[model samples]
Target chain A: MNLVQISLATGFLLILLGLYGALTNRDILRMIVSFTIADTGVNVVLVAVGYLPGREAPILDTIPVAEAASRITDPVPQALVLTAIVIGLGVTALMLAYAYRLFRARGSLDISEFTELKW
Target chain B: MNFTTRKAIPLVLLLLLGSVFYALFAGYTPDETLNRSASYYASQTVQDTGAQNVVTAIIVTYRGLDTLGEVTVLFLTAAIVGLVLAHSKAPKGRSGSGFLPSGELLTTGTRMLVPVILLFGAYVFLNGHLTPGGGFQGGAIVASAMLLMLLSDSAERFSHRLISRIESSAGLTYVILGLLGMLFAGGFLDNRILPLGSFGSILSAGAIPLIYALIGLKVGAEFSSILTSLEATEDSQ
Candidate 1:
């Protein structure tokens, strides 16, 4: 279909793929990678939702001031996505640190191997 | 439950979820016109913030507090990573003897590229108000430069004190700028503390570029610290 619809569909598919990987992968690092994929999907979907059919970016560089309001896509979602991507990076870094610590303590990277807390 | 059944269940659930998402998205249509807030930003960004980029205006001006919180979160994560890996033993060499020297090509290439990458990062953050790139993107680029250095030489060590000083000073400057906004402008983190220069110019947008530059430096330092800690752990092992 249109570019927006295509991007939306791809985003959803990516989320599903990431979810499946995260759920099935036994390795902590693999799961973290899967979560990052999911995060990317969420960002894509957010930006896609804010897109209008053929509107330009929300920049006033080329577009005249009079026509900008009608020509620009939603800026709010773009801003939100920008913040989300950075936060996702932070979260991913934290998870990786946790993985490193777990590996250091137990010498294993498998999530299933860390069941000592489960009573 | 059987192993095969357990595996199949998640797959089936994923399929179901995907179908649900597809159905929800299939009938949706994007509006051709901007909504209320989007239109407001599009029309007023230049006049209000003097930023050619509306998204930048919305990010640094309209949602400054969120950005501050985001920077704080990144800083916290970096701190936590350092703390978590603080006690790890140093990394032995590739053969478990001592630190191994990197290849000549890697070392030479890193030396050549690191300056260029750092310059690019500075450019991106400095022109944030006039372009699509911003503090976070530039900071990530700067971190990649550190990653390149780390990869090139295993024995090379970043000055932890220097990195922390840079991080703290940038963070403090950011806070003071926010306070300045509160005292001189509309509210916290306002980009109107200084004069909004000519639109589409680099010097315009008041404190936006300044704030973004500070943010980029702080974020870069934080990421560098994280990389250093991780690399330190590798050395201790």
Candidate 2:
């Protein structure tokens, strides 16, 4: 299909792959990586959804200001994705910090090892 | 549960989810035009904010409060990482014992690249209103300099006090600027507190460049703090 559709498919496939990896992987670090993959997939989907058939980026540097609405793809999604990417990075860092602490405490990186919450 | 079932269950679930995604992909149709808010930003960015980049205008002006919250979240993440890793830190005297010295090439490359990276980051944030880059991207770039330094010299110790001071001061100034906007301009975080200036120049877009510069500093400091804290734990290993 079109570029947008291809990107959308790729995004969906990435999400699926990530989810599958997270579910199958027992290592905490692997799970974290899987989650990041899924996070990236979500971001891709968002950007793809914002894409127009044939439009310039939402910057007015090249395109005239008056024609922006018709000329540019939806900028809202790009802005939202920017925020998402940053937040995702913070979350990943926090997760890694927690994982390091966990590894230090228990000397294990396996997800099944930490079962404090399990009933 | 059994190992086979553990794997099988996820496979089954993903199969179902994949079908759902397939349906969504099939049904999805691209929009023909900008939605209301998108159009509003596309049109209003010139007269209202005088920023060449509509995304910067929206982030630094229209949605400033959200950006403030986002920065707070990063701060909290950095703080928590430091807190979490504090007890595991290596003693000060034994900092560089274990790791082999990084080669001369990496050391020299870092030395050569770091200042340029820092300057580029500053440039990106400073001209955010007129270009594609902004505070977050610039801040991340600045943090990458710290990353490079750490890689070259694993034992490189950063002054936490200095980093925290920069971070807190930038954050405080950002808030004060927001309040200044409320007092002087239309509302909180209004870029119009100063003149919007001539469009497309570095000085245009009122306080966006200034606010973004502050954001870049704060974000860079926070990311560097996080990186430093993580690096500190390396010596304990």
Candidate 3:
């Protein structure tokens, strides 16, 4: 397969692996880590979708500005991915904080241990 | 749930999801050329925003308001983390006092590398418009320095008030720059408030470098705040 296909497959596989780990794991920390892996997969897929087989990065530092459109890959997805990565980090940190609070509250990290919200 | 069902649920769900993904992968076709907005940015980045990095141009110029909101979200996360962990923070004067001493090599290495890391982070954000690195990447690098310090020295106590000050001021300045863009140039957060200087140079890209520098500081502060909040939890143990 080509570079795009290979990367796309890798990204999807990572997402699946992360999802399986998250769903099967009982520990809150493990779930957080699994979700981070999934988040990384999403970023990789976005970047792969924006990839052009035979093109340079979308930076004008090296390439001539006049030929940028033909020479560079798409910058939109990359920009979106950058934002997504940062927001993902923020979300992970928030989740970690919540987990810490939960542990403090009940002295347990198991997801099943906290059933206050369960219907 | 029963043990068999618990194990089988994820497997069955994954199978269904995997099939969906397979269909998407089979049907997917890479585009030969840029889409409408991507093409616009590719062709017009240098002329419009004076940023050599088109991604930087899009993040800081074309989608500046979104960036502002992203920073706000980071700020909120940091604040909430601090608030949530505040009760567990070690009492004053008792923080960072009880841990075993870090070895000489780590301490010396961290001391030597921290300054260089801080400088590199500043350089990355300052040269954001000209290079692949930008505010977010630079800010993360800055936070790494803080992480290193915390790791190497158990007794190292960061001034929380100072970090918050930097974060607040940087965020405030970023918004002001956006307002300035509205007043002096095009719409909000336009980088053309100052003259788009000579291309490929550090000084080019108008207000991009300035705005990115502020973002770097703000992000760095937020990350450091989060790190300290987590680190201080060791005292609760």
Candidate 4:
């Protein structure tokens, strides 16, 4: 009914799709992409939690006179989100690079075939 | 097959376990009410740092140590990329062919967007002290611009030597500035060396913008070099 509930529903659906893709897809690259999608869904939920109705950015100049950032989106959440984005990017890049190498070495993108690592 | 299910189960279980762990243990908030907006650090960063951006506040001030670690990671990645690319021997004294994928619009669009991206990236880095963008974000943007150039105009080549030099020197400068901060200023990585000019000015931020600039150049060069090496490897193969 409310905006948060709608966003929560969408995010939950996205998480389910990501989980399905990560499971059903055989390609390692697709699995990684699915992982990213799931990560993004979680981030969306975190950001939604910070949303405050009718509150401006917490910057002093942006806030109205005598009216503080009541129920405004939390800056802490925003900052945390930014850091999470960076870490996600780093991890994604690393995964892709490794996937590329795996494809080159094994001539296949499927994770099921990567049993050479097991002793 | 059974093998596929086995592989899927580990990854699925890992993700589930990690989420459960996070839900259980990661609920600690700061004992102090450290609101990121309109806080002491923000004021200090604006007044004393001369940075036009507050995101630069957290980047260059409150979480500066984290920034240092990030740069170190970038530096390490660049080094490893260089090592990997170098080991794959092709031919000496040549950067090999620069064959771009066809369709003129991509190249044209790249040429058009490259400057805009560079300009915006510069703006982001310069205004990081007062705005939402900071060194890392802007630096990545600049790198993206370089990647665009690589992708669009395959003929536009970047030199490995130049790339290596930029990466090393910029990283070196970051550490040295940090040391200088420790020796002379309040502590390590302090922006107390340069005169914090009038707030909101380009020249403001004790040395914040300069640091961001170094980071931008370093990231741009490092990433471009990595892309270049990959292209070359693909060509050779």
Write down the TM-score of model 4's second chain.
0.74
TM-score of predicted structure 3: 0.96
Candidate 3: where is the Cα deviation over 4 Å? Answer: B93-100, B154-157, B234-237
Q: How well docked is model 1, in DockQ terms?
A: 0.83
Model 4: lDDT of residue B73? 71
Per-residue lDDT of B1-237 in model 3, one digit per residue for the tens? Answer: 789998998999999999999999999999998888889999999889888999999999999999999999999999998988888777654545245666899889998999999999999999889888999999999999998887775334557788899999999999999999999999899999999989888998999999999999999999998988887665456
Residue B217 CA displacement from its true place in model 4, Å: 2.2
Residue pairs with colliding backbones in model 1 are B89-B236, B90-B235, B90-B236, B90-B237, B91-B235, B91-B236, B91-B237, B92-B237, B93-B98
lDDT of 4 by residue, A1-119 (tens): 56655665566556666877887788898999998998898787666565554454544335432333242245556656766776566566556666767776789998879887766
i-RMSD of model 4 (Å, 1 decimal): 5.8
lDDT of 4 by residue, B128-192 (tens): 66566766678788878877766664434555677778888988898889899888888788887
> Would candidate 4 be rated incorrect, acceptable, medium or high by CAPRI criteria?
incorrect
Clashes of each: 9, 0, 0, 10
Native contacts recovered, each model: 0.89, 0.89, 0.91, 0.00
B-chain TM-score for every candidate: 0.90, 0.93, 0.94, 0.74
How many backbone overlaps does candidate 2 show? 0
What TM-score would chain A of each candidate receive against the reference chain A?
Answer: 0.96, 0.96, 0.97, 0.86
Comparing 1 with 3 on DockQ, the higher-scoring candidate is: 3
Output the lDDT of residue B188, model 3: 95
Kindly list the per-residue Cα lDDT of model 3 for residues A50-89, writing each as its tens digit.
Answer: 9988999988877999999999999999999998999899
By DockQ, the better pick of 1 and 2 is 2
